[model samples]
Target: MPEEKQQTPPGSETEMNVKPDHGEQSYVGHGRLQGKATLITGADSGIGRAVALAFAREGADVLISYLNEHEDARETERLVREAGRKAVLVAGDLADPAHCRSLVDQAVQAFGKLDVVVNNAAFQMSHESIEDIPDEEWNRTFAVNISAMFHICKAAVKHMKPGGSIINTSSVNSDKPSPQLLAYATTKGAIANFSAGLAQSLAEKGIRVNSVAPGPIWTPLIPATLPPEKVATFGQETPMKRPGQPAELAPVYVLLASDEASYISGARYAVTGGTPIL
Candidate 1:
């Protein structure tokens, strides 16, 4: 018998030859986000799945926003419900400003209120140099990563009361640029600046905005975005010598979304496997 071909570019967990470990059983929570309603983009797999599981465990009803990957999204929905919380799946291209507005509106409509908005959806392509970067890809990268955040925040804030939280997923590449991933890095830098600026602007309303800049973590993006050789040595360059797990990053999201981080805003938390950002 011949082997089935594997899907690429945000591979589906249900179709993956060996399912990527999403930390559903391993992540532990202490109800830090209890009663909060969180909407997470790219929630079907990888870091988004990890965060979704963690949020559900902490007693939050989650609205999962994903693009395609229906099987993975269904699995995420299953896991969220299994964690004893509600999960609402919102599917579409977040690159659209209208869709971004709808994401916040649908979540608020379904959950009655929106407390945490996690802008985690993104796309990246690796090229050896900036000259090789496609203009369309560069523009799309910024649209999905930074523009979508802007849209979601603008729409969600209308219904988000005081103490609402917005957590954007920046990347280590924001501060430490990866020459090959020029366009992707640029968007991440913008996300960092946007988070800081939005945090300050929303301070008077008591709505906190922050960002998480993760170092190399084992995710589907590794294989989808990088060459196979690069994928094989993905996190080897990090000081930890291994990519950080999604489970490891989940707690940071929980902390930032919880009342425990009441005093925190406009801060960037680097979960980059001992990679010094300074």
Candidate 2:
């Protein structure tokens, strides 16, 4: 990767210098999630988009929730539709608790019931020190990253049946903290703990809950949050010496969403290019 200028937080995927591979060409589905009704936050791009596409190809109808990235969201919708599945788009800020609940409501309304929920939307910013992180930024990070997941799940559980699944997008930082991403890292750690506790609580209900902790990945978030210098060498620290692509993480999500992972819950799967979480 080369040095690149930063975009605003929650960057636009279409504007990326090197477009991410969201399994547009490589992924092959096997009816793993056939006929399932799913809701995925941040489905506009990155891992979320990849999951949406994969789910569609696997025979699931998807409701895509985004944060005002219309162009990116539409592209994701097109991919879902292209895979011959239903796609619903909802744009709103996850920081607002009302919006979070509405996401679940809309998904249930659109699909009649929710079989899977992917809490993938997140807000992040890098700073040199704690003092540089503003109060509002810290609060917003937690609101979008972790709080939204809680609200969405609370509303979705009633709509979901015994075979439902919930997958949260955590980060390697949950185990190996990154000083530059203090707020974001903290929220990720909270998400891991939250998923663990929630999984045990929901076990009797038969709703599986898990987290995916990704290492450096080639996404718009890379250029948007990290400094140009750091962006240039992103993911090199991993043994793979390169970042994992959005497409690379979709299969794990597919398994979790599918009935195949019936016995898998309360676990955090790491896709870190050989970088171990512990």
Which number leads on lDDT? 2
Instruction: For each candidate, give its TM-score against the true structure.
Output: 0.95, 0.99
Which tens-of-lDDT digit does each residue in 53-77 have in candidate 2? 9999999999999999999999999
Candidate 2 displacement at residue 255 in angstroms: 0.4
Worst 10 residues of 1 by lDDT: 1-10
Clash count in backbone of candidate 1: 0
Relative to the true structure, how large is the alpha-carbon lDDT of every model?
A: 0.88, 0.94
Give the residue spans of candidate 1 off by over 4 A.
Answer: 1-7, 15-19
Q: Clashes in model 1: which pairs? A: none
Q: In each prediction, how many residue pairs overlap at the backbone (N, C-alpha, C within less than 3 A)? A: 0, 0
Highest TM-score scorer? 2
